[model samples]
Target: MKKIEIFSHNPVLLKECVEGLEIKPEGTYVDATVGGAGHSIEIARKLESGKLFAFDRDPDAVLVSKKRLSSYPAFVINSNFCEMKKRLESRGIREVDGILIDLGVSSYQLDNPKRGFSYRHDGALDMRMSKQGVTAAEIVNKFSEEELIEILKKYGQERFARSIAANIVKRRSQKLIQTTLDLANIIKFSIPAKFRRNKNPCKKSFQAIRIAVNGELESLEIGLEASFDLLKAGGRLLVITFHSLEDRLVKQKYKIWSRGCVCPPKSPICVCGNVPLAKLVNKKAIRPSDLEIATNPRSKSAKLRILEKL
Candidate 1:
């Protein structure tokens, strides 16, 4: 087996998340998506006797993070965040004091060509965040043009979804699209020559295919709900999302859970007896500072949203 040199990941909005968690010296914490132990290490440092349960679906990430955080005695689980509630229950951990979810592809994954996350890399078109899923190549080559267009429009927010889908189907007819460069080229030709000059013309299509292949957006919807339920009263959840689709889901879920009642105003009194689950700590998403953005261009699109359980 070949050895992979995995680099440490810089958690986006690191300070913001740690502060929002309001870490207590002896409070239990959970890092639902411990990509590279970035925030997990800090959470462990702040804890005197508190325990952190770190979860990640990627085996590569799990191995690296376990090694990086080995000294801290953190419980690292190889599982998706959507199953976090069940996993914690089995571990005899009832409620957590704080939960931090960094919901973006890690730098390590993007940088690794074998992972096929970056359009720059010339590798197999496999964009699975975990080893247990379909690949980007399958989605691009097998999906119907309409299905492809829907993914591009919804996940990527691409304006040329129709044209891109049409071109993909047209190209795949002659040859199988099996690599990052192959798909990138197809996306490039789909757009008119004038639009090709724009920054990252392939970005939208690649993002769309990646999201679909990994079921990322769907998992976010479920994971957000699970995270809210896992928190103990007064416990906080800090989620960092990278794109509009993710940010929108996080915002909408928080708004619903934060609502005081669901009954119509015409009702004389509250019927559902619903209480707010969490309160938004930041009504507006927190963003990276100019200095941070200058240092890490990837942080430019990050948005951090926090909620304290009521």
Candidate 2:
């Protein structure tokens, strides 16, 4: 096993995430997606008697975080953050003061060709965050054309989902799509020449396949709820999402939590008795500073949304 060295990863909106948490020196905190311990280290540093629970499905990330956070009062867990509630319960932790979730693929993963996350890479089609369960190759080869289309359209919001799906099926009929470049080429050719020139046609298709393989969105949905439920009253949940899809989910959930009424607009009385559970820390999502974007281009799409339990 190749030990992953602690490579530098610029945590997107680091200041915003930390400030949103409003860290109390003696309050418990959780870094749900502690990729490379970028945000975890900062949270750990601010703790006096408090503890930080860092969770990551990727074993490599867990190893890196464990080392990076060794100096602080942090517990590194090699499990999906969706299971955070149960895991924390096992440790006799019912609620935490704050939670931070950075829902972006780490630069380490993308830069490593063997991980097969980037469309720019030409490695095996294995985009598993945990390095376990179904690989991207299995989904690419076994899923039906319609299934592929649905994943691409729903997850990636790809306009050329139908064409991409058809091409994938057609190509797999002749030869198995075994590598990242293989599928990237198929996706590139599936779209028109003009579109290809505008942007990488494989971007959306690769993203869709990676999401499906890893169940990224499903896990995020579950993790968000778990994190919210585990937060003490007045506790904050700060999430940094990389794409519009993830941001939309976070925004809608925050809106629902911050709203007090469920009754229709025509209702004269509050029959449902639904009270607001949380309030948004910021009315709008926070974006990276221009300097940060220029220095780290990957942070360009990042958006941070925060909510505090009421």
Candidate 3:
């Protein structure tokens, strides 16, 4: 077993999440995606008597979070954030005052070559956030062209998804695509010259593959709803999303919940009488300042959105 290192992952929009949480000194809170316990530590510090439940799917993250938060009275659970309800129920805890989810791969995962998260590393094509899930290698070699295309198009937002899929199929037929370099090379060859030079061509494909491997986006959507339901009235929910897809999902979900009704514009009377569940605390997402971004480059793409239950 590889010994985990004590490297730091600067949590993006740290102050925003802590503030957005609207932490009550004696109110319980949950850090659903407590990677490295960056935000968890802050929450724990603010709590006088309230408890903190920190969840992480990755064993490595769980281990690291345990070490970081061990000093505080915290319960570190190795579970998917999507299973927030059952996990909390098992603990006999109900109605948390706040929840925070940082929905991005931790610096540890990306930095560790063995995890196979970064295309920069020549690691095995295993991008499972949890040890239990299917790997990127399985999806790349086993999934049909259509499946590959769908993943690339939907998750990656890659314009050349079809070509990438075609190339993957072609290459794997000759040899098993087992490593990061193998797939990265195939993606490089599949894309046009101009496209390859502008940005890391393999970036999107790797992201898509990772998402599929971990079911990350789906989990976020599910976890968001679950967290919403778990919050007590006046309780707050804070989400820090890295990319556009996540931001869009969070935005749409918040909009739906914040709206008074979902009936058509021309509907006679408000037929879908769904009262607003919560109000968007920040109509515009909060972003890290330039100084913070300079100090922690990983914070650059983070967008923080907050909602308070009515």
Candidate 4:
């Protein structure tokens, strides 16, 4: 078998995430999505007696991070961050000083054609981050038109979700959509010619399919709760989300956690007896600087948010 060469990953909002963590030299921390170990390396270097636990569902990422972080006091686990609480607890770690979760596809995943993450690449329609679940091709061919439309509208925010879903069903009836280019062509043709010239019409549909295949949004929801529950009082949880949907979820959750009461506006007394779980580090999401976006185009959509346990 050929060895997979691990490519260097440029971590988005690198300085901001580390600063938000406020790393204590002897404090234990978790790097929930140690893609390419870019952020993990930074977190590990700041440690003296502190330990870093890094998790990644992708086997390729596990191999890369394990080697990259081997020099430091870091332990790399091959698992999804959604199971972080259970995994950390199994290792006798019930609480942590900080947790950093960067929810963006690594540059390596997109740049590598075989990964089938990019529509620009004419590779197999296999967009599994772990390479162990339902593939994009399976979804495109097997899912009902309504199911496809729902994901396209909800996850990708695609305006022409119905049209695109119909086209996918129509095309797959003739033959299986087995490759990224095949699906891209169908989506491109589904949109109006004028709109196709403005941007890649396949972008939204591809994103929607990938998210559905990987259960990304669902995992994010579970992972956020697990991360928050595992943080000790005053410990921080930093997350970097790439799109509006993800940003909105984080924003809403933070709002709920920072609230001191849940009583109805009409009620005079605090009957709910709700207490704030955490306070937001920033009122708004922290976006990448102009230089960071210019240098790394992929960081353009990144929005960072932090909450400290109360």
Tens-digit lDDT string for candidate 3 (63-132): 8888889888689999999999999999998789999989979998888878888888889989888877
C-alpha root-mean-square deviation, each candidate: 1.8, 1.4, 1.7, 1.4
Clashing pairs in 1: none
Model 2 misplacement above 4 A: 264-268
**Number of backbone collisions per candidate, in order?**
0, 0, 0, 0
Q: What are the runs in model 3 whose C-alpha is more than 4 Å off? A: 262-272
TM-score of each: 0.95, 0.97, 0.95, 0.97
CA error at residue 209 for candidate 1, angstroms: 0.8
Candidate 4 has what TM-score? 0.97
**Where does model 1 exceed 4 Å of error?**
262-273
lDDT, model 4, position 82: 96
